[model samples]
Target: MSQIRLYDTTLRDGTQAEDISFLVADKVRIAEMLDDLGIHYIEGGWPGSNPKDIAFFKEIRNISLKQAKIAAFGSTRRARVKPEDDDNIRTLIQAEPDTITIFGKSWDFHVREALRISLEQNLELINDSLVYLKQHVGEVIYDAEHFFDGYKANPAYALQTLKAAADADVDCIVLCDTNGGSLPFEIADIIDDVRKHISTPLGIHAHNDSECAVANSLTAVEHGAVHVQGTINGFGERCGNANLCSIAPALTLKMNRPCMTEDQLRQLRIASRTVYELANLVPNKHQPYVGNSAFAHKGGVHVSAIQRHPETYEHIRPEKVGNLTRVLVSDLSGRSNILAKAEQFNIDLDSKDPVTQEILETIKNLENQGFQFEGAEASFELMMRRALGTLRHFFSVLGFRVIDTKRHGDDNPLSEATIQVKVGGKIEHTAAEGRGPVNALDHALRKALEKFYPQLKQMKLLDYKVRVLPAGRGTASITRVLIESGDKNSRWGTVGVSDNIIDASYQALIDAIQYKLVQDYAADKKE
Candidate 1:
């Protein structure tokens, strides 16, 4: 299969996403991650756009990369300036990239209206920008902005625009769906038409307004496109750009034309996660290759078949995409789910054991009352242990109160919470301030517990998430909390469910701490 180049714009277009922002350091870290994932080209940013991109380019040089060449994305020289003198072109040159992609007007309307230049002047910018960039970089990719629409409106002008860049010896001419509203059939038709005219290699840049970005990009490649441009996790303007996560897999796994290295396919999800985490936005759960929910199974019948044979329900092996299969526990769970969920905790259960039946019974009752064990693994373990009489509590919650004391001079915005507890034949009290009463209460609870087991400090809350089940069911219904925690290398998860948010969170928190202590105790026992 021919090698296709992947141009990642997570730093440039991804940052343009609504409500998405990443610090310079965040951009650098994600770049390194993409490099490690073996992506060929990482469009670091449009340094000519703003100071953030400037700072990103400068600071990122200090870090080491694995297999990615930096590319700077920008437009061709302005309508009135020489390509070499244009600030955008010069900035793209100075950014010191191995490659530069500059978009030029492919539409007559953009030439007459947007650039306010004669079609000839616009064509001059395309050729001159490519020539200048070729002098500064090893590769120059020219994007034909709105090429599909332009081709439909005026095929001669659009083909002429690409002819100019091809004559300038640009490495790739990328057909951009600038408006993002083009259909896949239109993309396929125009790319075939353009291919017949231009000898230069074709590339694709698609947007997702009609939700056809991925489809259009794939269609282009099927016809003869060589380069693909996208952002990690589909982060971009409006509905976002074509998602490289989907594109890479489609090209490599589905089409057998890998745009990147073989190893890149393995670290794909990790790469997606690194970008989302850096942006501080939760990764989409249904995102095709990398999502947490991608391979998750909740149905009892599905879990049983998977237990007997994995091929019954799984489409592609979860590990094929760097994700693991998850057997979720819910109120709809049956024996298979309980057994599978227990295995995740390394707990062995005998089918005929009385305690096994007791555990399932307890789960059903709690779930009927409003518990979602899938989110609260720790709580499930605690319940299982209680069934087998192996669970033990260090202390019990006597009372937790938030005193509405006058906001001190620098009092916390959230209320001050104090926790009182009975332990070791005596009552202990502690207080702390946090962003919220639950946070304060957690600190105080941990503070109190540390007196008994100092090892509790090694524990940390890695993730905390809450959801109200069957919303509009009123406040007295079920609330669920999922908590994932770790010491350093090992991460364990737990779930808690209750009618109250505070209660659900507290249950999940305690389960997390207890699970950590259990692991610590086991490690010490081995020692």
Candidate 2:
């Protein structure tokens, strides 16, 4: 099998995703990780787009990547403009990436309507753009914007667009499913047709509007595409682009196509998670391949089957992609599930222990009250500790009160909280002001406890997420708060649920703090 080149456009196209933004530091960090993951090319955003992108190109030039070539993305020169004179093309040259990718119109509709130029002029633009870039860069990848749609509308014109690049001796011509509406079979047939027309190496850049980006991309490869362009976790503008996490495993494990090395393939989940973490996005628990639920077993039968023969219920070994098999405790879970979860936490308990049964019943009861332990592993661990009589009572919250006030039409509202806590039989009271009620509560609680345990200073809240269980449940519905806390070494997530939003947040916040203290106690014992 021939090796497929993986081109990640997360810094470029992936940033087009709503709410996704990256600083120069983030782009450099992600590029390094992608290189470490054995990606062949990393599209380091368009050099002419924004100041941040420009800064990224400047900064990335200093870092020496081991395996991947950095590509700067831009569009072909305008219809009437000379490629050398075009500002976008000039910027790409200035960025000095050895590889440059530029998109030109393949659709006749775009030629006649979007670019408002004759068909001949569009072909000239494509030729001139690649011809000019070829001189400055070692390799030029020509992306045919809306290529599949163009081919469907006017195959002759689409073929002409690719022919222009091939005539200019471009290294690669990418067929882009820009609108993301093309199906897998359609993409396969079109790629077959495209292969018949152009001898240049073909690539596929697909979007996920039809939820077939990964399938379409894979189909294109199976048909003959040598290059695959996508983003981590399928992040892009509308539905998203093809997910490289899904594509890489499918290609390497299923198709027998070599994309990354065996070691690099194992780093898929870590890379996916790192990208999500840097983007401040909550990972999709159910995302295929790298998601939290990808290998998680909930049903008793499935868990039992997995324990006996993992291949019976699993498609692949969980560790193959740097993931682990998760046996969640729920109403549907059996003794095997409890034992598995306990083993992960290194708890010594037999499946037949009365305490294990009690914990299972408690989980079921709490889940009945809309508490999901699956997403809140820390909270579940703490619950088990409490049940098993090993829980460390770091501190007890006596009570907390929040006061909000705004005077004289002031734009900023004042939030204050007074907290009362009992630490090892000593009572401490503290009051603090913060930007919000939760912030105030956090400040007051920390202030009261920091004196007793200075190690609390090392831990801080990393992220806070709140979700109302069901949509349209209104203000009276139950709210679940998941708080992510981290110190110098590790991070943990704890969950809290309540009808009152603040109370839910408080529960998560306290759990986060207590979890930190528990770690401290365990470390002390180890010492």
Candidate 3:
């Protein structure tokens, strides 16, 4: 099988996504994980674009990478300036990377309109910039800006642009679908034409404006693309860039080519989630292979068929990409789903028993109460485990109170929360102040428990979301809160519901802390 080079731009273009940005520390963490995943090329950042990216390159040098070469990205040398004197070129060289990628216009329209340069001069720029980059780096890749559109407009000139990079001895000529509107067949035809025109190794870089980035990229690979450039999670400008999460698996498993090895395939989901988490964005629940719902079954017939033959509905096993399969219980669930879900909770469910009827009725009631078991599987599992007597809840709250006050000049209000609780024949009292009344409640709850469970220190609330049901909008209100918490090795999600928003927040907070303690206690006993 061929080993197509996989180039990841999750740190560069991926961070540019609107309302999504990464800290330098998070970028380093992602880069190290990608290196461990065996990606051939990781475009760390455009060191010349911003100070944060530059700092990332500096800090990454201290870490040891096993198999990935970090590439510094930049545009070609500035017009009417020598490559040696150009700041962009100098920054790329100063980054001290093994490979440098530069993009220059190949479309005549862009040359005339965007760059305001003659077509022949644009050709010289493409060749000269690549030739100059080759002198400073072991590998130089020339990205033919708008190569697909250029091919449709001036096929001869576009072919000449590739030839220029070839004569200049660029290691790879990556045909970019810059505007990202080309169809798959069109991309395939362009790839075939470009491959026939140049003897040099070919690469493909696709964007997602047409929502066909993955298809177009794979089509290019089917034709003759030996290298693929994409950002993890499809993050980039506008619609986004080609997603490496989908592409890597397609090449390695579907196409029978080894863009990444089997081990790398295992880390694909982890890499995708890491990027999403660092960008402070909620992960797409249906993002191809790595999403939470990728292999989930909710309907009666689908779940039953999946139980008989997973291949009937599942293209690939969820566990293959570091994710778990879910047998979702909804209004459409049948006895098979109930049994499967019960078995997952270590319960032997008998459809003939009244208890089974009771469980299904409870699910129906909770679903009516706006409890979505599909996204809140943890809550469902907890219910199933409780019904089966497998769950051992640590303790229950006897009472709690908050003394919160607002100051005139201070922006933050003065808040203090105290918890009075009795657990296992012992009473524990604790007081703590927090950023807000809700925060004060959380801090005091955790503080009281920390005395008994030291494992609470490792549990950090990664995310919190709240919603007020429209039906309960009057004096009485029903609120729901979801808490997603993480530790060193595991991430768990829990949900809470109550009439009072404070009560709902407290419920989730309790679950968040207890879940961590349970996991740590379980791990210790196993050891």
Best of the candidates, TM-score: 2
Q: Over 4 Å off in model 1, which ranges?
A: 60-64, 260-262, 398-435, 461-487, 490-501
Q: Where's the lowest-lDDT run of ten residues in candidate 1? A: 403-412
Instruction: Give stretches of model 2 more than 4 Å off.
Output: 398-416, 435-437, 465-480, 497-506
Q: Return the lDDT, model 2, position 393.
A: 78
Query: Taking the tens digit of each residue's C-alpha lDDT, what string does model 1 give over 208-283?
Result: 9999999998998899988898988899999999999989878877788966666667788888888787777878
The whole-model lDDT of each prediction reads 0.83, 0.91, 0.84
- Tens digits of per-residue lDDT, candidate 2, 216-305, equal 999999999999999999999999999999999999898999798889988999999999989999899898888889999999888888
Q: How far off is residue 378 in model 2, in Å?
A: 1.7
* Estimated TM-score for each candidate: 0.90, 0.91, 0.90
Question: Candidate 1, 136: how far from true, in Å?
Answer: 3.2
Error of 3 at 497 (Å): 2.3
Whichever of 1 and 2 has more lDDT, that candidate is: 2
lDDT for 77 (candidate 3): 79
